[model samples]
Every structure is written in C-alpha cells, then in structure tokens.
Target: MAKEGDGADSIVAATITDDAPTKAISSQGMESINATATAMTKAKNAIVVVEEACTSSKKPEEPKNPKTQVLIVPLRWMSLGMTRAKQQLVLLLAMRLRTVKTQMMTSKLQEVKAEADEKLKSISGENVLLQINCKALKNENAKLFKGYDDLEAKYTSMKALVKEKIKAAKSQAEAFKIELEATKGTNAESISKVAELLKSPPGFFKKQVKEYTTMVSTHILLVAKYLYPRIELEAIGEGYADGTSEEQALKLINDINGVATSIFNESLDL
Candidate 1:
C-alpha cells in the first residue's frame, strides 16, 4: 500500500510537470500573438503616416483667369493709331466740304456782280439815248428857225407885190366905170353887141384871181412844213432807232405824236 500511494503521488507530480510545460508553451503562443499584433499595428501606423504625408504634400492650386488666356492682346498704341486714322479721315472730309462751300459763295458773288454790271451798262445806254435825243432836237430847232425866216422873207415880198398891184388897179377904176357906161348906149347890131360884151371887164375878176393864187400858196406851204418834219423823223428812226421791240416802239409812237402836236400849234401862228 505504500508503494501504490507513492506511485499515485508521482503520477500527480508528472501531470503537474506536463501541465507546467503546456502552460509555458501556451504563454509563448500568447506572447507571439501579442508581438504579431504590435508589428501589424506599426505597419498600419506607417501606412497612415505615408497617406497623410502624401495628402499634406499636395497644395491647393490657384484658379485660372479666363482673361489671361489670350496669347497676344492689342496694345494701346495700336488702338491710338486706329483712332488717329479715323480723325484724319474726318478732317479730310471737313476740309472738302469747306472748300465746296467757299466755291459756292464765290460763284454766287460773281453772279451778283455780273447782274449789277449788266444793269449799269443798260442805264448807261439809256443816258446815251437821252443825250442823242437832245442833240437831235437841237439840230431840228435850227433847221425850223431857218425855214421860218425864209417863209417870212417870201411873205413880205409877196405882200409888197400885192400892195403895188392894188395901188395900180385903183388908178384904172374910173376908166372901168366909163367903159361900162359906153357899153349901155350902143345901138345893138348883133356883131357890134358881141364886141361890146367881149371888151367889158367883170366886176369881181381881179379880187377873185388874187384869192385863188393865195390859197394855192398857203396849201403848198402847209404841205412842205409837214413833209419836212416827217422826213426828219423817218431819217432819225432809220439810222438810230432800236429795233421795233414792243416797249421801245410804244415809247417812240408816243413821242412822235407829242412832237407832231407841238409842230401843228407852232404852224398855226405861222
């Protein structure tokens, strides 16, 4: 029984020994698991650090401006050149307009000057016409006065002749009365009667002959006076008158009528 009890105690001790080695092996396994866990955590922390470094390394980019996209922008000097070109064109057109306006003014002034010159010339022509008319009248007056003197001389000579003739006739008046008395006493044979009648003077014979001759002279003088003036007027018209334009023709007709009336009045006194 002691040997059995010792064997039992040894078995228990061996089991405890085996159990201690298992427990030690189990603890080593736990330590290996812990170490693996620590390694995995380090690796995870290193990956997180690298990811953070990569995120930190990237910087936010500045926004691009749409205005900055042009490869070449126009310079201020180029725009100034364009403006200058436009201004030059405007100045050129303005100068042309001014030149045209100046020409128009000059042309208008020339037209006015020409019209004034023409009017002046016409007025001068009218003055010349007046001077010529005065000269013509002056010439006609001299001719008319000369004609009047000649007519007066002729009238005086004719009057003297008539007076001499009347004086001579008065001397024969008694003889004529005697002859008429002789004719009344004749014994009337047909041939003797005829002879007496033929020899006798008619009562009004001398005075009637004188009156007929005087009437012829007066009528001839009147015709001459009017003919002289009419010929003078016709000569003047043919040589110097303007054409038979309406205005001038009317004026001429009126002037001629007035002159004729004046001549008639003067002739009445003559």
Candidate 2:
C-alpha cells in the first residue's frame, strides 16, 4: 500500500512539474493552445484527487468497532479514479507530442520557403543581366551591319568611277590613233612627190627649179606645219630674182625629207 501511494504521488508530481506547452500559441493558434491547456488542467486536477486519496489511505485511523478498524476504501472507486487519471495523462502527453511535431513541421516549412525565395531572386537578377547583355549585343550587331552597308556603298561608287576613267582614256586613245593615221597618209604622199622630183634629170630639174620651189612651198604648208614655221617664205621669191632658185629648191627638198623621215619613225614607235 505504501509503495503504491508513493508511485501515485511521484506520477502526480511529475505531471504537475512538466506542464509547459511544447508548441507556441502562434504556431498552434490561440484556440488550440487554450484547449490543450484546459485539458492539461483537468488532467492535473484528476491526478491531484488520486494523490490526495492515496495520501489519506496511509494515515492512522481511530480504533472504534472491530469492523470499522480496517480502512474501507471502495476498490472499484479507487481503481476507476486511477484509471481515469492515467488515461487523461496519456491523452495530454499525446496532445503535447502532436503539438511539438506540428511546430517542427511549421518551422521546417518556413525554412524551405525562405530558401526557395532566395533562389528565385537570384535567378531573376541573372535573367535581367542576360537581357541587358543581349540588348547591347543587338545594338552592336546593328552598328556593324550599318558600317558594312556604308563600306559596300563606297566600294560600288569607287568601282563606277574607275570604270568611267578607263572608258574616257580608251576614247581619247582612239581619237589620237585616227589623227596619227591621217598624218601618216599626208606624209607618205609628200615623200612620194619628192622622190618623183629627184628622179628627174639634172637638166630638167634646173629647167623646172622655180616651179619645183613653188610645189615644195605648197607641200610644206599642207603636210609639215612645224617645219613651215622655221622657213622664210619670202626667201623663195628673192632667190628666184637673185638667180639662186635651183639651190633653194634643192635645200627645200632636203628639209622636207628630214621632216618626213622623223614623222615616219615616230609613227612606227607608236
């Protein structure tokens, strides 16, 4: 009996001493905490009633009638009281365990949410940086395209200018070639006439000296304009009056030969 009383007292003391809630009211809600606290209070009261009964049973009683000498505690009543107190204690412990588990779950959920939010923020910052880089690259690409177009336009214009210069040079060369052919024809004709005059007999040349000088003067004016400027045209009339027409005619033929030879050589070089 003493041992059972001591066990009951220890259980009640433990129940009373360990009455702190495992979960906070913020996590479990005020209503849930209040209900849990009320249940713990009722369980504690039941344990206190059981402890009081056990303590009273250990006290010394007065010696009266022989039947009343033995302490008459209803076995069923004590058993029911102890059983209900134990059941309440078990229910309270289960409630506290459940509350502690819920609080732990809530705290872990908040931690996971915080980590997820941080990752999302980091990803968003990276995306913004990528967008900025992409925009700069696009602008750079556009500038390169514009510069390429400008260079291409300049290249086309320069090509056309070069073609125009080549065409004008070809046209000028053709005109010069036509003029050189005309001059070659005139020079050949004048050389053929001088050769015919040289073939004549010396007596016939002396007879035709005045006429030959006149022909030579006309040939100089027509074919060799550069040589014409060096000769004195008035000398032909004065030489005929001075009786030196043959000498003047022979000198004119030599000068015409020299001019024709130089013109033919220059044409061959061209």
Candidate 3:
C-alpha cells in the first residue's frame, strides 16, 4: 500500500506543471490583439478631422433675390425715353438747315434781278445816242444833195452860154477872113485911098479890137469863176463819200484847180 501512494503523487505533480505553461502563452496572444485595435481607432479619428477642414475652407454660393426682377422694368422705360429724344433732336436740326438754304437762294435771286436792271438801263441809253446820231447824219445827207442839185443847174446854164459865145466868135472869125481876102486883091490906088480914110478917122479899128478883147476876157473870167469852184466842190464831196480823209480831199481839190488853171491858160493862148 505504501508504494502505490508514492506513484500517484508523482503523476499529479507532472500534470500541474504542464497546465501552468499553457495558461501563460494564452495571456501574451490576448495582449497583441488589444494593441492592433487601439491603432485602428486612431487612424479613423485623423480621417474625420481632414474632412472637416476641407469643408470649412470652401467658398459659399450666392443667394438669389426677388428685387432684381422688379428693377428691370424701370431700366427698359428709361432706354425708350432716350431713343425718342434723339429722334426729336435730329428732326429739329434738319428743319433749321432747310430754312438757311432757302434764305441764301432768295438773296441770290435778288442780286441777279438788280444786275439785269442795270444792264437794261445801259442798253436804253445807248439806243438813244444811236438814234440822235442817225438823225444828224440824215440832215447832213440832205444838205449835200441840195448842193449837188444847185451845182448841176449852174453847169447847164454855163454850157448854154458857152455855146452861144462860141457861135458868135466863129462868125466874127469868118468876117475877118473875108476882109483880109478883099484887101489882098486891092492895088496901090486902093491902098492909098484906105490910108487917107484911116488918117481922117484916127484910132477907129484900134478901139473896136480893144472892145472885142475886153468882152472875150470878161466871158472867160466869168466861166472860170463859176466852173472852177463847182469842179472842186464835186471832187471833195466824192472823196468824202469814198471814205477818204479830209487831208486827201483837200489835196485832190488843189490838183483839180491846178489842172483847170493850166487848161484855161492854154485856151486863152489859142
């Protein structure tokens, strides 16, 4: 009985030693699980703090207003009033320009009328002067025609007188020729008788010859006095009508007088 009791005590001692080691190992594993749970809780707290900082830093949105819609009505009315005022100002300016243009055109018309009146007055004065000049020219022409008629009448009378004088001179020349022929036929007795008669009536033939010469000279002087002036006047008038100068007309008159004087002297000599 004493051996059996000693073996039971040893077996019980070994079983208690094994149960103590297993309980210590289970306690260390439970400590590691508690540390991991604490770290997970700290990470969840830091993520929540970051989300709150970002949200607080963002700009806020603008709020909508009901008064903005009401203000738009007054602004539209003001714009329409400004447009009507501009149109009124433009119309007034156009009317003023038209009035100014009309005034300028009227002034120009008046000036033209005044100038036309002055021109008409000048033309009337010139017409009057021309009429006066024409009247004077007509009077001068009438006088010249009267003078020409008188000259022509005088020339006709002179021609008739000259014809009568020439006929008388021819009769006298024939008589003288017959007396000369008769005297040529007379002899010495007839010549002595004629000499005795001439001595008794002294200067009878001389007086007759002197009277005939005086008559012929008077006739020739009368013809020259009347005809020479008429010839000069006619020549001067013709030169004037032909647009000759006064100096040229006078020169022509002198030439005609010289030619007439030479002709008259030649006729007298003959």
Candidate 4:
C-alpha cells in the first residue's frame, strides 16, 4: 500500500513540473499545473473509496477447516463387521452345544443297550439252570417210583404167607375137636379115673390143669352165654356146626389161641 501511494505522488509531481516549466512560466508549465491539480483530486477520491470498501466489506478471521474430512463408508463398514463377528460367535456357541447334546444322547443309548444285554444274559442263565433242575427232579421221581414198586411186591408176599398160616392153624383145631368128641363116649371109665387122679394131686385138676383148661372152658361158656331162642342162622335140623361159614368162626378163635401159644414158644426160644 505504501509503494502504491508513493508511485501516485511521484506522478503528480512530474505533471506539475511539466506544466509549470518556468524558464519558468511558459505555456507548458501552465498546462502541467492544471493536470497536476486534476490528478491529485482524483487520487484523493480513489483513496477514500478504497478505505470505505476495506472497512465495510472485509470479513473477520475465518475458522481453519482441515484439508481432509471424515468419510461415511469406512464407519459403516466397521459397524457391519462388528455385527457379522457377533453373529459368528453366536453360531459357534450354538454348534458346540449341539455337538455336546448329540454326544450325550449317544452315550445314553449305549448305556441302555448295555443294561438290556446284561438282563438278557441273566434271563438266559436262569433258564438254563431251570432246565437242569427239571431234569434232575425227573430222575429222582423215577427212582422213587421204583422203590414204591418193590415195597408193594413185598407187602403182597407177606399177605399171602399170613393167609397160609391162618389156614394151617384152622385145620389143626378142627382135627383136635373131632378127636375129643370121639373119646367122650368110648372112654367113660377112663374119664372117671383120670378126674379122680387129677383132683387128688392138689386142687382143681392138680391145680395146674386149671390153667391149661381155661381156654377150652372159656370157648364153651361164650357159646352158652347168649344162646338165642333158636339157632336161626342154620337149617332147622342141620345145626350152626353144619353152616357154610361155621368153619370161619371156628378158625378165627383157633387162630387167636394158636398165636398166643406161639408167643409162649418164642419166649422159650429166647
């Protein structure tokens, strides 16, 4: 600004010098003075106009703005990346949980199968044991049956022997009864003498005869005790001694007496 002002002042000075020459006041000098005056007035007005423009229109200091501004796309890209990372993390966790669940299910299935197999094995073993027991029981039953058969055969033989003994004792008693009847009529004198001799030895047929005679006397007493109005068990003339089953009655009593005598004989053997 100072340089510009100086340049303008010098122009004014030169014009005055020219117009006011002065060899000193010539026609050139007068023209130079008039140009100088006009020029100076124009310079003053221009200076005033410039000062007003500078004061009224010039701006105050501006805030400094950076050469490069923040961009939108890169921020958006970062946010999208963060969201994708979160989604990946969640997916990975879910996949791991699924794998764990599958493994647990597989293990449970295997355990159940193992338990079932164990139970089946136990059942099979029990069945085998039961079969063996059944076979053993059958064998024992067969042996028991054979033992029963032998016992039955022995019982049958014993029954037959007892029957034979009964028959033999019955025949001997019948023969003795016949011999006593025959002697009763034919030996009267001998009977009197024997009775007298037995009475004299001591008392009651020499005392010992009473014991030996008791069984025969008891049989005769029983026949006479409940004698009926008539012996209706047989034909009127042919007596009970003539009846079909009379032999059985006689044999039953004889067998009882014989069994007693045999027991006495066994005492002598001992």
Candidate 5:
C-alpha cells in the first residue's frame, strides 16, 4: 500500500513539473477545459477526504485485538493509496486531452494551407493562359491594321488614275467634235456613223461591264463566307426584320462591320 501511494505521488509530481504551453482556444475548447478542471477539483476533494479518514484512523483508540488493528491499518492505507492514484489519473487524462486537441488543430491548419496553395496555382495557370491569348490577339490586330492601310493607299492611287483617264478622254472627245464639224460636208455618212458609235457603247464594252459585275459579286460572297462561317447570309438580313430587339440589331450591325473590315484588310494583304 505504501509503494502504490509513492508511485502515484511520483507520477503526479512529474505531470505537474512539465511545462504546459499556453494557447488561445475557442469557446468549445474552453468548455472542455472547464469540465476537466471541475473533474480535477472533485478528485482533489476526494483525496482530501481519504487523507482525513486515514489521519483520524491513526489517532489513539480503545484497546482492540492485534489482528483487528492489523486489518484496519492495511485497509485504511489501501484506500488512501487508491484515492491518490485516482486523483493523479484524472490529472493525467486532462493533460492528454489538451495534447490531442492541439495536434488536431495543427493538422487542420496544415490541410487548409495546402488547399489554399492548390487554388492559387490554378488561378495563376488560368491567368497565364489569358495573357497568352491577349498577346496573340494584339499581334493579329497589328497585322490587320497594316493590311488595311496598304489597301487604302492602293484604292487612293486607283481613284486618282481613273480621274486622270476620264479628264484625258473628255479633252480628246471635245477636240474630235470640233474637227468633225469641219469635215461633215465632205464625209456625212462617216460622221453620222461616228456619232451613233459615240451615242451607244460597243457590245464588247457591255460584255466587259457584265463580267466585272459578276466578279464583284463573287468576291463579296467569298468575303461573307470568310467572316461568318456556318451562318446563312439571308439570316443576317432577317435580324433587322420586325420584332427584333434593338440590342440584337446593334450586335448584328457590329458583326457586319467587323466582317467588312476584315475583308478589306485581307484584300490589302493580297
């Protein structure tokens, strides 16, 4: 009985001597701590009661049989030792609970940090892809603008050339009319035929004009196909019909502008 009490005392002393680091805890943890403290307090009171009983038993008493004294002494000592052991076990259990809670909290924090890192990596990857796509669009836009400028320059030059040719043709026609008036008396038939030719274009010129109209139509069709793949051209015109929302009409207009601009730019490149 003495040995048991000494062992219990040693364990209690060791547990008390160890440093328990202080930590901030939540309301739930505080409740657990309060419950454990209450249990320890009860165990301490039990120990006090057992000690008092043992002390009272030790006091001098009326004469009794030697066998009875021996039995009573051992029993008292056993009860005291058992109470001390129970008190220490309660303390031990409280400490174990605190340690386990700390470990669980630490593990939970590590898991949260790991999940945050994974989400950050995914967002970074998406940002990189967006950046790459933006750069590609910028490059394409630059090329389109360059092509548009070149096409504009060519159109300006052709317009100037056509104006000059028309001016030259008008000057020649006026001079020929002045000469024809002087020659009409000697060559009346020839003059009449030349006048008729001047009034109406030759058949070859009409054929050339027709071929030009067809070529322009074909080019327009090709541009439309390039700009709006998998969509019917008639559907675009239908978008402007009755019951179309204003926003939808505006979107269609913008789409048409984009297609026309793209076609013009591409033609300049060619």
Candidate 6:
C-alpha cells in the first residue's frame, strides 16, 4: 500500500508541470494581437493625409446654371445689332452729302449753258444788221455807175460837134484871103466886101470857142459836186469791209479829192 500511494503523487506533479507551459503560450499570443492593431491605425492616418494634400493642390470648378447661360447669349446679340445700326446711319449721311454736291454741280452747269446761248443770240442779231446795210450800199453803187456812163456818152457827142465847127471856120478864112488877092486895084466895093467877109468868120470862131469853154467848165464842176462825193463814200464802205484802219481810209479819200480838184482847175485853165 505504501508504494501505490508514492506513484499516485508523482502523476499529479507531472500534470501541474504541463498546465504551466500552456498558460505562458497563451500570454505571448495576446501581446502579438496588440502590436498588429497599432500598425493598422498608423496606415489609416497616412491615407487621410494624402487625400487632403491632393484636394488643396487642384483648381476648384465654378458652379453653372441653365438660366444664366441662356441670358448671356441674348445680350451679346443685342450689342452686335446696336453696332450695326450706328454703321448704317454713318453710311446714310455720307450718301446724302454726295447727293447735295451733285445737285449743286448740275445747277452750275445749267447757268453756264444759259449764258452761252445769250451770247450766241446777240452775235446772230449783229450779223443780220450787217447784211441789211451791205445790201443797201450795193444798190446805191449801181445807180451811181449808170449815171457816170450816161455823162460819158454825152461828153463824146459834144466833142464831135466842136470838131466840125473848127474845120468849117478854117476853110472860110482861106477862101476870103484868096478872093482879096484876085480883086486888088480893080474896085473899092469889091475890097470892102472881102474885108467884111474875113471879119465875120473870125468873130464866129471866137464866139464858138467861148461857148464850148463855158459848157465844159460847167459839166466838170457838176461832176465834181455830184459824182466825186458819191465815189468817195463808196470807197469808204469798201475800206471798212476790207478791215482797213479808219485813219488809212481817210487818207486815201483825201488823196482822191486832191486829184479831182487839180483836174477841175486844169479844165478851167483850158
């Protein structure tokens, strides 16, 4: 019985020794769980810091509304329309100014044309007057030329009659001289008859010469008074038509008068 009791005590002592090791393993497992929890907390704090830094560095987005966007489009269109209206007003004023300038130019052109027409009318009137005067002068010249031709014909007839009278008187004087020589110392009556005959012929010749001289002088004076002035007036008209100076035309007329005066004086002397 003493040996059986000693074995039972040894068995119980071994069992207590196994139970102490199990309690020590359990305490080590609890310490490992606490360290893993602390590491997880540190990782979570680092992720939160990264998220805040990224949000601060990025640009913020502006808020947008549908009503504000639609209102901006209409305001921009109104501004564009006002600008176009101002440009159109400036263009209209420029066009009006151009129209006024064109009207003024047209009026000035019409005035100039009116003045030119008046000048042309005046020139036509002057030309008509000149034509009328020229025709009258031509008629007067024709009448004077006819008168001069008639006077020339009469003067030729008078010269022929004076020549016949001179021939008859010379023949009678010769015949009386021959008769007186033939009847000499014959009779006083015969001699007295011859002497009377000679005196008669000489007296008739003297009377004829005086009458012819007086007629020639009167004719010449008539031509000078009536024909010469008309001829000088015609010459002045011609000079004016030929564009001669007034002084030169006057000098030519004076020269013609001087020649006519000299011809008249010579005829009187004859």
Report the number of the highest-TM-score candidate.
2
lDDT of 6 by residue, 16-73 (tens): 3443333443444445433433332334332233233223433223224332221122
Better of 1 and 4 by TM-score: 4
Model 6 Cα shift for residue 257 (angstroms):
56
lDDT string, candidate 2, 91-124, tens digits: 3444464565567679999999999999999999
Compared with the true structure, all predictions reach lDDT values of: 0.51, 0.56, 0.51, 0.50, 0.58, 0.50
| Candidate 6 collision pairs | none
Give the lDDT of residue 218 in candidate 3: 58
Global lDDT of model 5: 0.58
Against the true structure, what is each candidate's TM-score?
A: 0.27, 0.39, 0.36, 0.34, 0.38, 0.33
| Candidate 4 or 2, higher lDDT | 2
Per-candidate RMSD, Å? 44.7, 19.3, 43.6, 37.8, 25.8, 42.4
The clash count for each model shown is 0, 0, 0, 7, 0, 0
Superposition error at 88 for model 2 (Å): 2.4
Mind giving the per-residue lDDT tens digits that candidate 5 earns over 1-270? 233434435545644554541232446555654665455344433333333333454533422434223212222344354544333334444455445556767999999999999999999999999999999999999999999999999999999999999999999999999996675444345547966765588788767766654565456776678977886778654556788875575556445766665655565465
Candidate 5 residue 163 C-alpha distance from true site, Å: 1.8
Q: Given candidate 5, what's the lDDT at residue 136?
A: 100
After TM-score superposition, the amount by which residue 6's alpha carbon in candidate 2 deviates from its true location, in angstroms, is: 34
lDDT of 3 by residue, 1-270 (tens): 112223323323433344343343344444543443343233443223322322333322222333222111221222333333222222222233334445657888889989999999999999999999999999999999999999999999999999999999999999999996675534445547966765666487867655655665455556766877655544433536667775575556545666655655665676
- Top lDDT prediction, candidate number: 5
Q: Rank the candidates by TM-score, best first.
A: 2, 5, 3, 4, 6, 1
> Model 2 TM-score?
0.39
Which parts of model 6 have CA positions greater than 4 angstroms off?
Answer: 1-98, 177-270
> Which residue segments of model 3 deviate by more than 4 Å?
1-88, 185-189, 192-270
